[model samples]
Target chain A: GQQVMQIPQYQHVQEGEDFTTYCNSSTTLSNIQWYKQRPGGHPVFLIQLVKSGEVKKQKRLTFQFGEAKKNSSLHITATQTTDVGTYFCAGRFYNFGNEKLTFGTGTRLTIIP
Target chain B: DVKVTQSSRYLVKRTGEKVFLECVQDMDHENMFWYRQDPGLGLRLIYFSYDVKMKEKGDIPEGYSVSREKKERFSLILESASTNQTSMYLCASSFPRTGNQNQPQHFGDGTRLSIL
Candidate 1:
């Protein structure tokens, strides 16, 4: 079974500071998706990356897929209080012709006001 | 705006009791999934149904079952609830745009179940 590891299990940053979370995998992945879950809320889709070395941006947030497709990272510039939540990276892989998505343990981010 | 609805937002049951968690999706999705979320374990899949009357076991499916008699409805059943089963249950639905492409999943608010 493939597993995804997320670094910085918990983090706290002063408001207006930068924040980043890394997702790593031992094996190559077909694609990777990022999700955000607010306190007492369900996980919501943020973005997905497929091609290697791909970089995508959503306003102040940037996402990048590693050149080898074995890792991904999410970076937020000037984090705000509303940016506080748990970020998760899910990787898709195939096993015996069956496709599965392995979700990372997640990185909890806290913004200090 | 896709809406995935779970029957209950919170539930509590005693050990050894049979519990059923219901989920419904307004969007006509081809896939429905059940996952349990723990503090450090992330989201562990329990079961998924791609079509009506079809189900597949996920990473952690022991002591659990699923029913998908209709396309819009998916149910997760606990044969015998235990204290270990106390966690947040999430239901998701996705539409397969193509055969191999995996689309974004729409999740319900989730059910926080506690076993006494």
Candidate 2:
């Protein structure tokens, strides 16, 4: 079975502070996707990382995939109140069927004004 | 933008009653999935369909079944509702990916189901 685990289950930061969440997978993954779920809302796709040791950025957020493709990280620079939500990392294994994705427990981010 | 709609935002049912959670996607995605979200469990896949009439079991499909009569519709069925089955159910749809690549999934708001 494949598992994706996230660190810092919950995080609280003041405006202008930085935050980061780590994700590790039990098995090697072909690719990994990041999603954000707002309070009382559904999960929304953020970004996807495919190549090993790849890094992508979306405005204030940066995503990195480990060289082994078994780990990933999301970093936010100068966090804002609007960044409050739970960030999840999902992985698709190399040989596993593509029908389903294994989602991480998620890191809940809260920002203080 | 992709939109996925769930039949209900909230539902209440009694034990031993059959329940169905309907999901529809405006985008003609080739893949659809059903998942349950709990406080610490995150999103656990229950079932998924790659094409109409084509289905597959996911990580937690013990108490669930799925239907995919059409490309845009996917349904999750609970044979007999139980208290332990109470959770937020989510439906998602995505375009099929090639090889080992993964596609982005669009999710509906989800159905909060309660079994008494």
Candidate 3:
């Protein structure tokens, strides 16, 4: 079975500060996807990383995929109150010709306005 | 835009009662999934269907079952609901493009179920 673990189960930062969350996997993943869930809301798809050592940016957020394909990170620059939410990383594993996903425990972020 | 709709936004059922959560997707997707979201557990897959009449048990499928009679509909059934089963359930669908390694999943608002 594949497992994804995320660090800093909770984080709090002042507005305009920076924040980052890390996701590590016990096994190699074919691809990884990031999701955000606001309080009392459903999870929304954010981004997906597939290539090794790939980096993508969306506005003030940056995502990086490890060269080994076993780790990923999401960094938010100049965080705002609207950025408060739980971030999750899901890894897709191909096992025995079956592709399934394993989600990390998640990192809940809070921004102080 | 992909639209995944869950039958209910909230539900309350007594212990030992049978529960059914329905999900429908307007887009024709080959893969549909059911996941339960808890406080710290994130989202754990309960079941997934790749096609009609085809389903695979996910990480936590005990006490839960799924039905896929049509490509656009998927259902999750709880034979006997328990207090421990109370959680937010989400339904998602994805269409994998040919030769593409990543497929974005569209999720519904989710059904918040509580067992009394």
Candidate 4:
């Protein structure tokens, strides 16, 4: 059984502050995907990391995949009110076809204006 | 943009009642999934369909069944609902086995089911 765990289940920060969330998996993963769910909205795909020790960025957000491919992190710089949401990391194993993703518990981010 | 649509945004059902949750994707994706989200428990996959008329049980599929008669539509069924089944149900779709690049899942708004 594979389990993905996230730390800091909830986070609150000022508008100009920074925030980060960590994700760890019990087993090695082939790839990991990040998603964001705004208040009263569905989970939206953000980015995916495949290669080990890979890092990707989109504007104010940065995502990193651990060298072992069993962990990942998401960092936000100068967080804004628009950044308030729940961030989730989902991992896929080596197997193909019909293999479902294991999702992290998620870190709920709240920004104070 | 990919669009995944769930029939209901909220639903209420009584114990022992049968429930049906409908999900439709406009992208004609080969993979469709049903999941339930609970606080502290994360998102648990209940079932997924990789092709029409084919379904596979996921991590937590005890009281759930799925149907995939059409490529664009997938349905989840609860034979007899219970209070413990109350949670936010989400539907997702993705392309399957395309290449090394993993396709991200597109999710619907989700349906909050309440059993009384």
Candidate 5:
């Protein structure tokens, strides 16, 4: 079974600060994706990284994949109130002739006004 | 735009009762997935279907079965609902990728199911 674990299960930061969450997988992944779920909302697709050591950015958010493809991270610059949500990292792996995707426990981000 | 519509927003059922959750996607995706979300458990995959009438068991498929008679529709069935089955169920659809690529999933609003 594939497992993905995230660090800092809950994070609270002051407005105008930075936030980062790390994700580690038990196995090497073919690709990794990031999703955001707001309060009382479903998870929405954010971004995906495929190549090892790949880094992608969307506006103020930066996503990075580790060189070994077994870990990833999401960094948010100057967090705002709108950034309050649970951020999840999902890793897709190629198992024994099958494709398996595992979702991390996620880091719940809260911003203080 | 892709739309994954779940049949319900909230549902309440008694223990030992059968439960059916319906989901439909308009994107004609090849992959449809059912996941359960808990406070700290994140999204646990219950079942996934890649094509019409083709289904596969996911990580947490026990106590759950899925039907995919059509490519655009996927249904999750609970043989006997229990208190532990109370969670937010999500439906997502995505295009099946070739080789080592992966497609981003589009999720529905999710149905918050409660078993009493």
Candidate 6:
């Protein structure tokens, strides 16, 4: 079974600071998706990356896929209070025939006011 | 906007009782999934269905079961609830788009179940 693990189980940053969370998979991934879950809310789709070493930007946030396709990272610039939540990375294993998404333990971010 | 609706936001059941958690997706997705979220374990998939009447066990499906009788509806059942089963249950749905194995799953608000 493939596993996806995330670094920094929790992070607290002052407002206007930066934040980054890394995700690594035990096996190669065909693609990876990022999701955000706010307090008392459902998980929301953020973005997905497929190409190796690819980088995508969403406003102040940047997402990167590792060259080996087994890792990914999400970085947020000038973090605000609204950016507080848990970020999760989910990936589909390259060789796994099943269409199940394996999610990381997640990185919970807190922005100080 | 995709709407994944869970039947309840909170539930309580006694031990040995049978519990049913219902999920409905309005996006006409082909795949549905059930996951349990815990403090340090994160989201662990319990079951998923790609088509009606077809089900597959996920990483942690030992004490759980699923039903997908209709495309828009999926259900998770705990045949005999236990104290360990007290956790947050989330339901999600996705469609297979071009090039992507499956679209990103849209999640429901989740049901926080407490088994006593």
Better of 4 and 6 by TM-score: 6
Model 2 Cα lDDT, one tens digit per residue, A25-84: 878988999999999999999999999999999999999999999999999999988999
- For model 4, report DockQ: 0.69
Model 5, B1-116: lDDT tens digits are 99999999999999999999999999999999999999889999999988899888898999999999988899999999999999999999998876677788999999999999
Clashes of 4: 0
Name the top DockQ candidate. Answer: 2
lDDT of 5 by residue, A37-69 (tens): 999888999998999999999999999999999
Looking at model 6, residue A20 earns an lDDT score of 99
Question: Rank by DockQ, descending?
Answer: 2, 5, 4, 6, 3, 1
DockQ for every model comes to 0.59, 0.82, 0.65, 0.69, 0.74, 0.67
Interface RMSD (one decimal) of model 6: 1.6
Could you tell me every candidate's TM-score relative to the true structure? Answer: 0.97, 0.98, 0.96, 0.97, 0.97, 0.97
How well is each residue in B1-116 modelled by candidate 6, as lDDT tens digits?
Answer: 99999999999999999999999999999989999999878899999999999998899998899989999999999999999999999999998645754488999999999999
lDDT of each residue in A1-113, candidate 1, tens digit only: 76899998999999999999999999988888999999989999999898889999999999999999999999999999999999999888755223357899999999899
Model 4 misplacement above 4 A: A95-98
Over B1-116, each residue of candidate 2 has an lDDT whose tens digit, in order, gives 89999999999999999999999999999999999999988999999999999999998999888999999999999998889999999999999987666789999999999999
In candidate 2, how many clashes are counted? 0
Residue-level lDDT tens digits of model 3 in B1-86: 88999999999999999999999999999889999998878899999988899999899999999999999999999999999999
Q: Runs in model 1 with CA error above 4 Å?
A: A96-99, B97-100
Q: Best candidate per lDDT, number?
A: 2
* Residue range B1-116, candidate 1, lDDT tens digits: 89999999999999999999999999999899999999988898889888899988888999999999999999999999999999999999998635545789899999999999
What DockQ does candidate 3 score?
A: 0.65
Q: Candidate 4: give the clashing pairs.
A: none
Clashing pairs in 2: none
Greater-TM-score candidate between 3 and 6: 6
* Per-residue accuracy of model 4 over A23-97 as CA lDDT, tens digit each: 998778888899999999989999999899999999999999999999999999999999999999988877634
lDDT for each of the candidates? 0.92, 0.93, 0.91, 0.92, 0.92, 0.92
